[model samples]
Target: MSDIFNTSIIFKSSIFATPVYGPTTIGNMLWFFIILVLAVIIAKIVSLNLNRFLKDRVRKNDLNLITKAAYWLIFSIGFLTALPNLHVDLSGILVAGGIVGIIIGFAAQSVVANLISGIFLIFEQPLKIGDNVLIEDTLIIVEDIRIFSTIGKTFEGIYVRIPNEKIFTTTITNYVANTARRFEYAVEIRYQDDAARAIQIIEALIEDEPFCLKKPGPSVFVDELAADGVIIKTRIWAPSEVWWDIRTTMLWKIKCALEKDGMEIPFPQRTIWVNLDDGDSTPKKTIPERNHVAEVRIHTCKPSHPALEKSHPNSITAYNGPDESDKE
Candidate 1:
């Protein structure tokens, strides 16, 4: 064991006096280990400080990204420094890595797109965690934003993972983005009902709701003359947090108040008239009785077809038949 420990090897034109393995000396190996340990310690310290600095100013996702980038950067620098100390050549490795990087870039276009889009989202801050948003047809509450995807918990209590690229490219409606939101409802009443009375009822109901805003005030007006009734449109503003609650509750209240006041909400209706007898008729003929004998005759004719008249002894004809010359 002593001989093995004391064994010496020499290579021509080597820089180190003693060789542990290949061209590397024991001292160099020790130094490399020390550098690696130092790298880890420094990386941890830098990451903690970076997290602290970014905690208040940036989103959690962005903070995490910065911290990870810091740690990796420090570790990579340390690794490159140690590699030089160990006499490793990186020229061929860098060339190979460049070629591989190009192939990977082509293969992972979508992945790269998502990553870049996620970075932009973090910087833009269009939405945050716990925000209610409508993306296209999906309504969701944001749960987490990651580098490649965004996680959302839907109103139905289901978790959804959307790629960052899709989120960045689509239209996003953030319900909680503003402090106040407006809601409109069209209430219909019978055409005979008083429009002013219905409007007053709706305005009163909106005023009673605590969530409704007063500075901008609520609006009520006749919107249109519908077939069944008059449309009274009501517009109100409320705090975003309670907008939905106020909208639903106030509509019910308005409807109940209108009904209680004898306002009618008319349904679709139609009217039709019919005649019992055929409407087409010619002038009537009156006969004078000479020998105390009176007789009356009745005839009916349709517009499409005329009926033949019965001959009376003292009757007068109102219509003359077509002339023979006219027929020819």
Candidate 2:
């Protein structure tokens, strides 16, 4: 028993009694450090260069996409390279990440939908920035396109954010997609006035407007006969940007020009008929009804002509006076 103990003691004392580290230990660690540092440096340079390259061409929407992808790629590579230092098993980590990623993906399916939809929007580009669009009947201007959402501005200057997924699902109308837009107005002339003359006057006035596109020729057509007069439909094509301005100013101009051309303005008229029940078997009605021709001493409205105003009817008519008219 003693001999066996002595032999075992001698063997233990003779070899590896004290532990010694070889140079390879530090070399391996240094190599790992160098590799990791080099990987990081390369990743940073690549990310920086990519950012610089894409800074101009990418829209605000693409910003998040590119940045997220770059960050994830760099982090993933760093994590993998640092696995040895952390003593973490990649196989297990990869498996766990796969499982968790799947769960997260399912849980955030709508987010994924929005992301995919936004990607589609980026590619499809149905509406560009500053486009006037009608989405599901709501007027919106494309303020910015985002990775998962679209930012819009309303006519009232209110900002609206819509998810890309929902935006893609809705119907969109782009008003400014084409260069030219149409403006139409229904012009009614008095029933007694000449229809042919009215049409020519309106067309001439429209032609005088520089904003109106002449190639389209400012059409005038006979519209429906309204209750009081003939309705003339006038349509003009103008630049999209000048639609409102042309319509507003041209409408007033057309009215004044037609009035200057002796075009009569129509007013609504209603006639009254009375049937009195009397003691006659023949329908109990008379031609005069009561046999009285009441003269409604028609005081015609003369718009206070420049020639005269009735004195003592009250006060003097308000005008700049004869000298002002002579100046004209």
Return the top candidate by TM-score: 1
What digit string (tens of lDDT, one per residue) describes model 1 on residues 196-260? Answer: 98898888888788888996788899999987679999999999888989888888888899999
Query: If scored against the real structure, what TM-score would every candidate get?
Result: 0.61, 0.57
| Global local distance difference test of model 2 | 0.72
lDDT of 2 by residue, 95-135 (tens): 99999989988999999889898889888988777788998
Candidate 1 lowest-lDDT run of ten? 295-304
lDDT scores for all predictions?
0.77, 0.72
lDDT of 2 at 328: 75
RMSD to true structure for each model, in Å: 15.2, 15.5
Top candidate when judged by lDDT against the true structure: 1
